[model samples]
Target: MNRRERRATAARQSGRTSPAALCQAGFAHLRSGRIAEAELCCQRALTLDEQHSDALHLLGVLCFHAQQPDAAVEWIGRAVQQAPKAEYLLSLATVLERQDRLEDAWQHYSRALSLKPDDAGLWNHIGDLLWQLGRMDEAARHLQQALKLNPHYWEAAHNCGMLLLELGRHAEAVECFDIAERLNRASAALHQMRAVCLSALNRFDEAEADYERSIALDPSLAETHNNLGLLHWRFGRLEQAFACFDRALALRPDFHAVLNNKAVVLLHLQMLDEAFAALHRSLAAAPDDAQTLFYLATLQLLTGDFERGWAAREARWRLPSVGLVDRGFSQPLWRGDRPLEGKTILLHSDEGLGDAIQFARYVPMVAALGARVILEVEPPIQQLLGGIEGVEQYIGRSSTPAFDLHCPLGTLPLAFATRLDTIPLAQGYIPAPPATRVKTWQDRLGPRDRFRVGLVWAGNPDHKNDHNRSMPLRTLAPLLDCDVQFVSLQKGVRDQDRAFLADHHDIVDLTQHLTDFSETAALISCLDLVISVDTSVAHLAGALRAPIWTLVPFNPDWRWLLERDDSPWYRSMRLFRQTTRGDWASVVDEVRVALEGQLSARRSRLVEPSPTPSAAPVPAAATA
Candidate 1:
């Protein structure tokens, strides 16, 4: 009885301990990352007790890590249904996420979080899901809770920063990134994100340094390279920008923003073909990208491909800058499809002042088609444009009169299908007679014998190409010292030019007295000639049919065309182009030579005796 009883008791005790012991050993192996050993132990435990929840959960996790999510879900679902626990539910949710069943995964996550509300890991997962769903505020709240639960949770901190970055909270994102660094996470992603925030805040030097650090850590991050390219591009460092963009493109060929960015750099470099090619690739990648479509239209216009450009450029209203303007129109746009024979067309002022002056030439042509035209123009240019032939009424910005149809001033060229040859300029359309302000200007000038030439060294500083189109006042100092009464025609002066003008008292700074463009036009009418950089004043001179010479940049605006001595847009305008980028020296020299020749001609005319009255009235005298 003793031997039999002893043997039976030992057997029963061994059976009871087998499943629990196996389950414990399986978890220990899993923690040690010995997958095969963990699997063996888990299987043995399940074999001993087929319904063991710990063994089932461990097996499900193994299947998930082994890339068998379907099996993992099947096993974890059974474990969860048998005994409801937060750990089992969490594992099931993760497996579902890997399977791309986000909705189901979300439900499970919510359930798990309800059971374990204070778990930092659970909160992190919830935050991740909310972020992906675009619930940024909620995602941020959840992520913050995760960090509050566990201050050392680097993943949660990093994700919160990423969410903030997307929300355009750059300063906050940078701070969050700083908090994340305390966890000793030194990945490329952290540095890259910090760089993006810094760049947005215009911290260029810090952003560039961070970019370098990120690229050094992980050379394969195409986005990091592309961002660095943008940094370089903003500073006009096209060469460096191109190199970084090319690297990003090679790393990720379908990166649409990168392709678009590369095209911008190419455009600045004046490589039109390469620029368009990059643009095409970007459009192909994201066909509905409104910004890219609008950019393409701008490029087409630059290349003088107006027909296609206009068609694509209709997207201009979608651009942020353009969208900000008051473009509201209850009436339909007249794209020349409809006859304007008897219609009242409201031709509104659009774009810059120069464009308004240059395009006013078309109002007469539009009216010649038997349509009554109303012009809505900027208040400053209203009086100047009032004389335009065919404009039935001149309206200011505050006035919106009744009209049968409406069109932007820019759209007229497209509506008219204007090519280079179709450009029409009614010389002296904006006429300002010499006698109109003769006394006013003469009194101010105090009887100048030298040639009276008006000067404008700069255009609007807000213009994107002002750096190239406008020259320094010092650059024009040589021309000002000549035997001519140099009168400044610039109404808005640069801060840097005040000192230069003060040093040279000969230059008559009449801008202070010039109230509006109309006053400027009257003053200009009393001048012998006008010398100006590419500005609205140049267009005004051209419109008045005054003798004018314009300084053109190397990559001049499309209106000036590529290599032309004269502009079809304005008949009285002569173009003096830069042979090199940002070079105004050559342009100044050319203007000086032409001015000297004019002075010589005037001197000769003054010295020469008037031709004896051609044998006139002699017959009557002889008869007497």
Candidate 2:
């Protein structure tokens, strides 16, 4: 017989004449994927009793499954009004939430909770609603309540983990994920989330193993591959990262995040052309993606395409990476849009200390426009920048100085439409430290028979590329073998470098007394030259017009463009680059040779007559 006749026969055989019995049969049919039969049964029940809440609720569920949320809401509302049951309230709340009526949904959920105070599933649903509304802390509390109500609630545990992950409590999130995995080992998504937490905690090996496990569980999931690719990228495993990204793309061709990640890996591999192509595809997929746009700007700037780079780099302010420091200023950003003449402009440094030093050259240019300039920068560099010539006021960052306009220090290049060669004050705009601080450093040195050189072999450990840019004190052994007396310019030394520093008593370790950038600047002025990795001290040295040799990585930051020894930003600075990625040994070897050359040049100058009197030395940031 046909399906309808069979259902009728079954109904007759079961003697299901009452509305409740028919509604029960309707739910059974719905669970079995017999949508038409389910609807028929529910309609028959509704015909028998027009106010049957169960039948109405069943029909609402069917409508919700059919993507008719509006009709589902109508049916469920009637059912809840007639029955006032907890289940009916839950159904109505879920439908209202689907319709984006969050407040109405919340009220209904509260009513359901009031009726059934210990329903773990209902508590989980409430937590989900709060999460959607961006009430993360409340959502976490509700999810925790759900877990407390039922320890075996896998969904609640997973939700709690995800919420904690969003809150950046990776350790707590990992604990929740661990509980969830114990409950549901076959969940690929659970393993992937655990891997993300591990990765955030810098547990690379554990993170990679979990990612592999997740991929093994569900090979079809594109996001797992994408996330695995990011993990590989973090450790400089370029080939593996590229492979994961390729696999993700193969699984889902339009995955924009994977595309951007692939582009990043390509950039690291020095495949600039391919990287650009990937970024363009990503931008096409998500036109206004800030991270993608920022990478594009980075590529342009790295390749000396300043025309587009300066303008595109403006996307940094809108990026999530910059969100914490974005000053949401009341005054409009002055990008040379209006005349600066007679207007008070607040120039703020919202980036690294090196960036503040490098971009401080613009303060004089801005003041020359007849506008009063207020320089707002980090406290360390405030005294060092007292001699920028045109700064009307040097205010602490906490001060809310009244101004007609404001601009990020980094955006000054774009303000003037800076080109390849038009960088102002290439010969150095920042002045030397006061003679008093210089004398303090000189007295600390006692005797000056040996050539004085400042050394900074490491950058900030917390920096994303610190592994690539920084080296241990032991790495500078080749340089220390020279006749010149080396002074430590590093502010914070890693635990691994402490032993080596202690053993090498010949190398000055007066960093304990160097309280701020002003002290560091004064010490740098006493030295003949400053040699550092890509860090703030390198920039400080260059800005002071002191001789500086910066050791650059293979894929250096955008500001240090490719294949050049000299910097346009700082005329007093020279760059020493690694021919291969992470090959610091080669860079050190080059620096050693250059040091020998500089010593020879110094001896030749001493022997030969000089036209000018002998003079001194210099300092690099992120986010430089």
Candidate 3:
């Protein structure tokens, strides 16, 4: 037992029944975890002297520890009234705060602070309460005061760091974490929190070191493991990421976020069955989790399970990670819930250029339903896509046009109840480029003497999966070696590719003249074929019914289903998929062999001409 317990035992053995002695014995019993004995002692002391403030305070503490907040408040308030002591007031404030009587708690806390003006712990407590109330600025001030009063206050420093981290002030949070670490180097939680700040600042190596240190200090921190897994996931270390997630799940089986994260890595690894199982388990743990549901939708769509995919696709808007704004228009969103005989419906683009291009096919179908369709899409493709058959009006991103109902373009598939077989315009729907624009491209190119191909090797670098979907221009050297005219349809070529492009003069770089999708479309119309990676250009070529061979990654975006050479969404598109992840060489080889075969077939057809008259020579410009 503690020293107080020993003294209390000596007093009891000597038959000392004084009120002060009994109160002391009670506190000793309470400290030693003898709840029944402590309560009996407090009652006996109160019977001897009902106004004994120490006995009353001990009883209040007992009630608090027993989870009787109401009774604890009554006893503590009585003790405060009798003694008017700072410690008694502090106890009363803590109990009142636990009961969520914020005003009462503040009154008691203010009384205690007034009595003990320099109490650093009291300042920290108030700061913590303010943080919970979302009074961030006040919380920071109070926490700073606590630190100023006691520079070595680890708790206050840690609290300040957490607040800064919540505010997305990673650099400031790291400074606070540094202060905390100096005071307590053995704290695993401190290391973990600091690692999160480092990760946010993109100091990956430092973050990894801190994560390792935290795990070494305490292996049971499931949150630390989950965070480390996310870092690994960002770097594409799939196996390591899965291991960390598995460890986190083992520590906390009901960790729904970890389960969801694990499923995402599984999806990237093409372990569809495993990802499906993990997502279901996460839903079982937390059924209404939007992120998990969105991932499940993505997995389903990737595997061509369109029925369930479209059903859950609406969850994307609810996810902060997707960053899709709800637009919150006054008009209700139409999801085929009501007939639209004469109503005007706004169909706006919700995602990237390729997605807008792919889903714009739904405009005609919506118009056929007797609704006036006003299409709002990104400005870059607005001119080209404005000509979609059913679009009565085409506007740029910021328009607030009059419409009876609205829907994001991504949600159109669900509104149409689209399935694998029900995807609209598989034979292509986008109208041909305007004649004048096509003529502009024709004038730019004099003649086509060889097979003409447009090449797009990369897409937007900021895309999340750009590393997987896009390749260096050098990777296409084999394909470019073919005896054919090549024109770069790629915009925004990276600095790494600029030197190669300068050396390879055979490959025409005409992108400087192509300002928007309209210009690109007109140029695409003149080319015999388009060879592109998964990008907006590929989608454009497909929608225009132009011949397109799209190179796909091993684990492609949801649109390109597994192991298929053809796309259900685009009939004119042919897929060339990588057999392994990051193996662009193999894909390039396959495309090169296909190109050579097509050339050989053309030569044979030309020599075997018999009944049909030889056609007029195809202009060499056609090759571009």
Instruction: Write down the lDDT of every candidate, Cα atoms only.
Output: 0.84, 0.89, 0.90
Error of 1 at 471 (Å): 3.0
lDDT tens string, model 2, 366-450?
9998899999888988887866989989988889888999988999999998988898898888777889989989999879988
- Report the number of the highest-TM-score candidate: 2
Worst 10 residues of 1 by lDDT: 1-10
**Stretches of candidate 2 above 4 Å error?**
1-117, 605-624
Model 1 over residues 398-429: C-alpha lDDT tens digits? 88688998888877888888876677774557
Order of the predicted models by lDDT, top scorer first: 3, 2, 1
Clashes of 2: 13
- What lDDT, from 0 to 1, does candidate 1 have? 0.84
Q: Name the better of 2 and 3 by TM-score.
A: 2
| Candidate 1 backbone collisions, by pair | none
**Which is superior by lDDT, 1 or 3?**
3
